[model samples]
Target: MKHFATALLCGLTLAWISTVTADQKPNVLIITVDDMSCDSVGAFGCELAETTPTIDALAASGMRFHYAHVQVGNCFPSRNVMFSGRYPHNTGVEGFYQVRDTQYAHLVDAMKDAGYYVAIRGKVTHSTPYQPYAWDQDLTIIDGQKQHIKNADSYYRSTKLGIQSAAEANKPFCINVNVSDPHKPFYAMSSKGQVVKDDNVPSKIFTADEVPIPGFLFDHPDVRKELAHYYSSVRRADDCVAAVLKALHEAGNEKDTVVFFLSDHGMPLPFAKTALWHHSTRTPWIVRWPGVTTAGSVDRQHMISAVDLMPTLLDILDLPAPNAFDGSSFKPLLEGGAQPGRDVVYKVYNENSGGNRSPMRSVETKRFGYIFNPWSDGKRIFKTATQGTMSYRAMRTVASSDPVVAARLQHFNHNVLEEFYDYQADPDALHNLIDDPQYQKEIEELRAEMRRFMVETNDPILAAFDKRHDLAAVSAYVDQVQAESDARRARKRTNKSPQQDDSLFRLVVPKQVQAGQAVLVKIRHTLPKAMAEQQFHVTLKNGDGGRVERIVKTASGDGVLEIEFDVPANLKTKSVVVSAFVGPEYGKHHLHRTKGGIAVTQP
Candidate 1:
């Protein structure tokens, strides 16, 4: 993706250098990491045992901003805003939609036009091309099991490759190494707590008790174990960061290069990665500008977003900040001077198509967070998130009888009230104060403030955002595309004996079913040509309630089982089971008829 199709010259030759301020042009380096939260760093008051020496060293040399945030909470949208210097809505990519270049030039193009040898080393935004015209070179990567760039070194190598090319051209370079660390499967490179692949991967997993599993989770042991696994990945990320800095030092660019280190967004846990809440969207920004920003300085006063970064770099380099940017330049603050920044920085999301869920947009300040849900009314229909290998998703595979965690999972899936948080009293945002009488004034104030931001930024949400199905519709449509992809794969597999197969039984709901409506369960057997007809009992049970019973099972076709019954009128969300116990239950695969995430909305 890094080969430029053609060169766009800003004509920054040493001869042309006489036309610009000679002392102001500084080389820029942007390093972005994956799902990392404030909890992993010591600077954020996280009590971690391992040393984050590289990140700590970087912070010690420059400034760390405690209140830095992202324009959106999710990865694709955050990258969109970061690249365009605009809001996610304005970029026409509320979530993972393609970025339209006509609306905004990428930061690389802008910086390149200003005569900088700009090159991208890691996951470049898909909204733009990996063509030669866009970047000087893109370095190849060895993907981790989870299919993202593994660590800072994965990116550093790419950047190093780009640096070699830049040297051949006699160019001063602006390099961006987009690192992927600290994201998930939660556990690093393995299923168990063991590090199977890279010896660099952390071996010991963190537990919820070890790291404060953000309150949004049920505060359960399982969730804590998940948190520990996530922190283990963070420890490995720190080591990777150390490797990158060492490369810069070895290359003799440590002092001259302006190194900016940060994650695109927060963690991949509940209410963190995809949501617009502070824990998800807030970025941990640390910049080391050798002679400019003071060493070991922590700035908590200013509110800055990733979108503000490009313009800030432009300003500090004595380049004109593009008028199209929605963010203000913060060169003064970076240069060791102080000026008043915004009281608030707005964040939003159209949807998280990856998680197969709803749309959410949140506005946050030092003290408050207000989310606008376009699907709060529950009238929307979306694809079930549990369609794949995600454990949280696979758990829904047997939601019936798994009431506690299932309901919590569904609460997130279905989402809750129009979210409003008092960061002061409910920093973890456990209790939503959106409709609370005591917080009415605060909610209204935030609403008005967000409205002004929308107007000023020409946000498309200003027109589309409502107490309707805006977010759900957009996300579901994308899910429809994904579902089709899954469908294609599903069709290819010949299920000769799915009944006797090792994997559990699977079923499909052809259409939406509602409360008190008739639900039909159809099961098929994939047997070798002769072993088609098999006797199997189909059972139905409410996964959440204690009720368990067999549904109508008048054994039918040579390779099929079908059951139809009137669903309970009062049931809001429930799963049906079709398990057949053969030979005293020593060996039998559990076949499940799962719900297809349909909301039977009240009139």
Candidate 2:
């Protein structure tokens, strides 16, 4: 305990936290379920009876948000927004891939710096900026054994452990308990349709006939069976929630702790998981801040995004929020006050789990929703996690006989460039009113709103939006974005050290260069001011030192330095390493250095 305090004292940088005593600070407990829709809870409007009794109870005792949405539909990006108070582009976590060197401070970082004991349970990798996060306690593993994700009691034990450990440390607790139920490999069935046995069982198991089909999906027997499994998983998730809250009560911190409950995103199904539709981003946001929020209250007047979670919680604790946050504190809304500009929310999706680039942007209001998909060029197939589901398979089986089903499948495979939904009448987003002349005025208004959001956030796909009417311009932008995405994936794969991301310069070289041909080496940098008067020293050398070339050039005013070197015809090595150094004066101690590899071919 003494060592822990000493270590925290050494690392803690928030000097303002010292003014508040440990008892004055409230514990923060965030309970998140995976792949759950907002309508899945009975309190929110799940037709399936008792699907989430524990969550419904929490809503009854807390403040339920009726128009809460996540910034993204996928797991990692959505959870990252909840913690970092930033959009996917700002955090560089646009997909499932890890962004090791994030410029933003996370929720845990703020809580820990404020003299709280931070911990996490499940979704350990997805929730944090990177894996092996410096949590005061990782409840995922205890006594050298990893807790089972599906087991409801595992969460109870982990929560109890976190609370007791925080008590021992004499600090407020901020623990994120992520339950893994309601995701894929749901309750009773495997990834394949085979039945499976598990020790952890839901209190009430659902049958296909009893479960209600979501509005976004087709009504099929296979889909019904899948929904049955999903509902059963939701029930188990309810049990996990009950267990966690019970642990909090047992520790006698129920009133002293502020509880937050929400799903990472909507269901993991077609048109619901990865797509920027109504159900994709809508989340059941519940907050139980004792002594602050009125019980049994619902906030339907304001639309909140998951991005606001970080700043709002920090505000609740009276902690200073980082200036880089894209989200503002909704503490006023939670305190039964009104806030303007709560009528709309902005959403984005960049890449999927498989590293496929399908950039999308959207804006949603109470009555309308508009989405712009730059990657949908009518040729590139959209890849997502939903294609592997039973519902999609059922759609494929019936597509041959049903033209409607066939069209739906094709639309799912290749989306159109733009989509507009009358959300008031069609919450499922079943119909696209992009060409409806009656709603042209409303559609134009939504487009203007989306454009404002894109410009405000500095969205990368703004060029595509600006030239959406021109297919050629949109196609060019899409291609450029895809190439950049591929390059980023390659860099992340090869560069392990986070410091490599801090390099002021970037070197771009072709894969192969002829021995007698002129080779071009491009140096890119963001430090235009620092390199305005500097020079670039470029060198190309082989492993055996049989061939070497050197060139020096002044930095270009456009932040890109292009240098050409002629390779010797007598070059014998199969490859060469290209290195570039930027400095005001030529010397070994330069400002920045970058390297790339190129292959040598005989001409």
Candidate 3:
């Protein structure tokens, strides 16, 4: 009897210890705001009052990082970097596509493996390979009517459901609540098809006059109007943040949860979102960890990247980080320790949302910023998401009237190859100091640092810097490599079965060819024997002025079609679109179309 009682007591003690250890593990809640700049948050110093009361309160109750940046400025890549703790190049996820390899361990997967219930509430498609990163409870709805967290009520309900589900599972939770506020097509619209005031947006909607304009933009009337709508969206995003935090408290998980609040990237404006400028990659980062992080503490000394988020979270949870991660844990910095030799952060820009190639890389320090624009050969005009906005249209209208605005507009449209900015003196990055002799030494040092980083990371575009003037060659190389990758993926998917194989067709041309020069247009395809000898019509249309050039090409014995055409000497456009079709005579099927255009530079 005595031996049995002793054994029972030991078992009970072990069970109690296990329960305590599980309870000690903190829950994690990440609230991500889309297209929100660091300066827009009230806690980060928005001049406009009440712009972000909820976010401000969160900051005051936690730690705020003043100089945190994302590895890439775009949405998908930035979020991927945060989740994978790797650079875009490393993960092969520079755009909206998923990483071809499933070997990589995701943060949510890691959390789930470590016995935590994981959930993602909004913006489901922003991260790729939905199967590998599948959550225990996915509350994201993509019915086209409302894809993301629509309003405060929906956010509150979704968050509460997530917490409750985790509690029912009897596991600690890690939830990602992506709010799609302030992205585009702002809350309210007017009769003139302009963004106007609406009561449903926010309680205190900012007016055009009350909006604080960034130094990069001209203070035009239309710009202010667009900004007013953006501010209203920002306010709405803040309310969503408040709602999520409220849910955490009401669920009684506030004290045991580590809350993270940040933007995927910067605001969706010119020189901010798609470009490698100051405003492009900077994000507002706030962390609230009860008893671990000091309340109201601010960290301005460390320059952290979105890539570090995964490793840092793992460290905070006392879990081991994967060896594949490029970023190390910044947990020491959060615990009042310094991260030595962490002054500079690197950034990259590949293709935009439209799949247009405008490769850029940069090295940003606390006081200086250097940018390398590989596509800027004086002919390739950079077009991105900002082009569709009303503010850009407004700037174009006033360019002829205002010379300063005209110069700014011209520079924004046609950027030079290299740019250097003293961020301390000019935070807007308006002045290009690359040619300034006073900063020659600084420029060289930054360039060396950038080159070293590229080499260390094995950046595929590092070779393009040497051929900066030859935009066409660089574009061709990138396209060919991507085509080969796609073909390999397709081959694997079809298991090399000829009957099931639909040939991959890619139009390969130099991104930028000199006017009046003979350019080779290669149609690379993997057609089966049945379609190998089929003839196709190839059309090259000027993107700027819509000049068309057509030619009939017969596929060679090995399924390769090569043709040469003289680029029109008097071509008014800077880029050309190459497309092919196998039509009514062969079959009612389209061959393939180039995702983007080929550049045509001046001779």
Alpha-carbon TM-score of each model against the true structure = 0.68, 0.78, 0.75
Clashes of each: 18, 0, 4
Residue 309 of model 3 has an lDDT of 90
Determine the backbone clash count of candidate 2. 0
Task: Give candidate 2 regions above 4 Å deviation.
Answer: 1-23, 492-603
**What is the overall TM-score of model 1 with all chains considered together?**
0.68
lDDT of 2: 0.82
Model 1 agreement with the true structure over 89-138: per-residue lDDT tens digits: 56666644343355567777787888777666555554242222356544
Candidate 3 lDDT tens digits, 28-91: 9999999998899988888899888777877877788988888887888788888988888887
Estimate the lDDT of model 3. Answer: 0.75
lDDT of 3 at 186: 72
lDDT of 1 at 36: 87
* 347-453 per-residue lDDT for model 2 (tens digits): 99988988888889999998899999888888999899899999999989999999988988888899899999988899988899999999899889989998898
Q: Which clashing pairs does model 3 show?
A: 471-512, 472-510, 472-511, 472-512
Error of 2 at 297 (Å): 0.7
Tell me, by TM-score, which candidate is best: 2
